[model samples]
Target: MCSHTCAPSTLLQRDSISKCSLCLCTWLNPRRWLNLQEYQSKKLMQDSGVAVQRFYVAHTASEALEAAKRLKAKEIVLKAQILAGGRGKGVFDSGLKGGVHLIKDPAVVGELAKKMLGFNLTTKQTPKEGVKVKTVMVAEALDISRETYFAILMDRACNGPVMVGSPQGGMDIEEVAASNPELIFKEVIDIFKGVQDDQALRMAANLGFKGPLQRQAADQIKRLYDLFLKVDATQVEVNPFGETPEGQVVCFDAKINFDDNAEFRQKSVFAMDDMSESDPTEMEAAKWDLKYIGMDGNIACFVNGAGLAMATCDIIDLHGGKPANFLDLGGGVKERQVYEAFKLLTADPKVEAILVNIFGGIVNCAIIANGITKACRELELKVPLVVRLEGTNVHEAKRILTESGLPITAAEDLDDAAKKAVAAIRK
Candidate 1:
């Protein structure tokens, strides 16, 4: 159930915050980047001489149709480029399901491509500026007889890399764990010590792999572990890693997240980043060097502390409301920083109300209040704003808001602020 793995890195931030809590590196640490993009992922597999589908990325529908014709494949897969999971049935459809409209006809393909490119999938991962379909991939579809899960991830318990294999692949792994838990198996590997032959053989035999396929699987396992070390990857998973009738092993789905801090040493890997599928808010935040993750729900939240931001969201959910985003403004904040945070939070149409919960502590509430006033003076601030300011300079902060004529509701505590924000959205 825990797919999240930590990478190793050493980066010195002003706050020295490690982006990936489990990873050795943070984004600040320069290393290669491995984004969860189909094109880039397939390219990695292709470079390693692994068998994967030949695919073309089309920015327009016309290009998709053209590529489809060139490949001479009647059936094709159209996927919206994104890092989110469950694309097919979820908001970001990979178009792997049957009845997916194929571009057999040139005109139809063009139309579909144009439509998809222009459309946005407002999934739970990115409700703000839903993932835009900037480039659609057109690839030959495969008739998979059986699918398996193959992944090499860091095992904290073993303090090394672990290989996970499951005959139950595709769809939800949790469902498989609940229904048939016996099929999934894990093999520990000490990459520095190299994978033991007996361990590899046992893993292969357990997965029912034999003949040439067993050798191939074992080889792939070794290759994957090597790749993990070479790339300093935290996780590498091929879900429903398929098998052709001829026993040909193919990776169908690949999910990878790089140690952001390792970018310095991994320049070549980081160059593969594709921003086409990212949310607009996230892109904007990255441009300003802010840490933010877009989520569903109506209440937009902004806090000076990460821990407080999470607590605010939990309270909102408990009050029968959802949070729009998780934004941490960090410490030693200023008026301009607070203004920028508000701008990004309000940009999303899903945000019906705004919650400003600042404990202040190291930050002065008066400065944040000034920024809130400035945002109200310049931007729309169409949604109601409920604020709670408790730490530094609370009096001046309240005074600034009272004079701003911002129609803002002030609460002395986080509980009161969260409840008021949720109620504001409901009303």
Candidate 2:
């Protein structure tokens, strides 16, 4: 299940039970969006005509201090720039109390940034190893009179877009949805017509804003929706969409995720991607157009399609074997890709055995066989290897493997392949 703030909705039809559970699970998980850091999200919102706090991004401690000086606010806030949430409560490896801080004196901003920059910040949303903070955001701290939650997301239930809001802001929206589902308000928008003015107004009022403030929030909602469409965003979340002591409405914190499919057209937005936050192996796999996800298991899996990859993992687990990774050699795979995928699998110290499950529809089993033999010889692969090839030139593939005389065990079917791989590892 995805940990995104969006409320979960039924994405598959009940009659489609015969469909692959992997496909159904993929649709249900909404964490596929490309996430941007807080400062980047705020900049996008500010540019989209949505009111946001004044802020500056800095890569160094000196720059952080300079940004705080330039703001000249009586009080300033320093935030560690990591992709994950729960930064306010996150702790730094340096024993620093929190990733976020409010300082009365601008002079101390640099000290805090020194503690944050280059240090790992562990948050509930992040892995235990945590993500390193290479950047910091220095912004004017707001004195809020009220707080609210607002977001625009592509909803499967609506079969289009939906606006979600709540007066209970500055809290986990998922927790809010679970504990008090009635407090959350949703307005489904027709993809063709967009968010209507009446709908915005109704949502704004439902968020507990009144009079001019309601209209102002409504206007902000429309602007957010426009930005969502403009940037091809999958989500635009503004938590603590707040009213200040001065009666002005502003977006205090924001998070935005773009659709990966739109990266070509949204070049500028996609360029902001910080590769440092990504898994090194996953990044390497991306270079070869291979889909790889690491897991905590001993058997490495290589399959052709997404559904088949997942099914392979399931079968391995069912046989009391855990998968070390999910490596999907998507359709039209080349020999080089197969070799590269093998390299990634063997590189993992956890992988004691490897399984190749290919039901070649558009892929050539011969290519996979050639790549495997090439890798086994050149790379001196020490792990036990199990091969299961089906469809399209599988006979030729088998002949090649057999003639190569490699120490590879052949399986008759998926179940046999999974069992052999598991038994080999245990031995």
TM-score of each: 0.71, 0.90
Choose the strongest candidate by lDDT: 2
| Model 2, CA-based lDDT | 0.85
Candidate 1 residue lDDT tens string, 1-427:
1224311111112222334433433332112134557877777766776677778888876787788777777566777666654455544243323213444554466666666676665555554556666777777777677777777776666777877777777766656554666777877787678777777767766666778877777777677666667777777777777777768767777766566767888788888787655556766765655667677788988887666776787899998889987677777787887778888988888989999888878989899999999998789778899989988899999999998888899997988998999899878
Q: Candidate 1 at 155: error in angstroms?
A: 4.3
How does model 1 fare in lDDT?
Answer: 0.71
Winning candidate number (TM-score): 2
Supply the TM-score for candidate 1: 0.71
The worst-scoring run of ten residues by lDDT in candidate 1 lies at: 6-15
Per-candidate count of clashing residue pairs (backbone under 3 Å): 28, 0
The digit string of per-residue lDDT tens for model 2 on 338-369 reads 88999999999999999999998888899999
RMSD list, candidates in order: 7.3, 4.3
